[model samples]
Target: MTRDTQGENAPSDLDLTRLLQTLTVESDRYAERFGSRHGLHRTDVNALALILAAARRGEPMSPSALARELGLSPSATTALIDRLEAVGHVERERPSGDRRRVALHVPEAGLEEGRKMFVPLAEAFADSWAGFGPAEREVVARFLDVSTEAMKAVSAEWAPPHESQRRR
Candidate 1:
């Protein structure tokens, strides 16, 4: 019986770990370059990116909703929204139905930046995915979804005992 060379010659788990670390460092460098071009700290850029994406969803934006999406505290989310407002990247409006609630909407400038950052990311992912058929794409998507959920479960289960203290 002949054995497959691919399985026989596969790198060990440690090699995969090193490979992932290298990829993460490269990805961070890319994000840093993009962030520098936009004159934003990485976190600020990420917050603005999320806000613009939510606006594109065609639903009224709620600060609470954004907070939920980002896994951020309400106060932190408010602070982020405030920063965006101060920078003229976003504005708040009181919808007619709810005077007490504020809705976040991105200004044209914010949308433009979001577009600039998202275009390349989207294009790169699409280009890489072009090699996959529908079945393969579906399998990959399902695996990613399951992996994400599993990681979330593990994180939640092992919640740090002093997470709040550590944040300060």
Candidate 2:
């Protein structure tokens, strides 16, 4: 009988919304732990994840491209790449005809370590999805895609990085 300001059910009382929010928080904690275990900073792990994602999509990532995706300056990205290279986590190469572009690559050892860390969780996810038929899985995928875009759009309108944030 009562309507909130939005004239809809409050998100706090929505099971799916709460579950998605909680998953986002828990996933952040998991990512932090995983990064620590791999001797990488959280952002470094995120960069590697992005690189792996691009590779999976058959589009290799370059240092400048990674900088753009990571929201880092060119100098900062170079420093990050240097650290990873020192640790044998990534290799730099000119994969394309553009000699000025530096392609980032995860060596076999790095890939193996990543596999060891993530394979179990990936298998569990796959096993869970195995219970759903193709139609159900498709619906779930579509929902996730829409949810992601909605969140992204909402995020763009949120308080952006101010002077205080930039100082950090």
Among these predicted structures, which one has the highest lDDT?
Answer: 2
Candidate 1 wrongly placed segments (more than 4 Å): 1-29, 52-61, 65-75, 158-168
CA lDDT of each candidate? 0.73, 0.81
TM-score of each: 0.66, 0.81
- Model 1 superposed RMSD (Cα): 5.2
Per-residue alpha-carbon lDDT of candidate 2 for residues 31-101, written as tens digits (9 for 90 to 100): 88888887889889888888888888888799878977777877888888888888878898886678876
CA RMSD per model (angstroms): 5.2, 4.9
Task: Report backbone clashes per prediction.
Answer: 0, 0
Estimate the TM-score for candidate 2. Answer: 0.81
Clashing pairs in 1: none
Q: Find the number of clashing residue pairs for candidate 1.
A: 0
- Residue 62 of model 1 has an lDDT of 86
What ranges in model 2 sit over 4 Å off? 1-13, 158-168
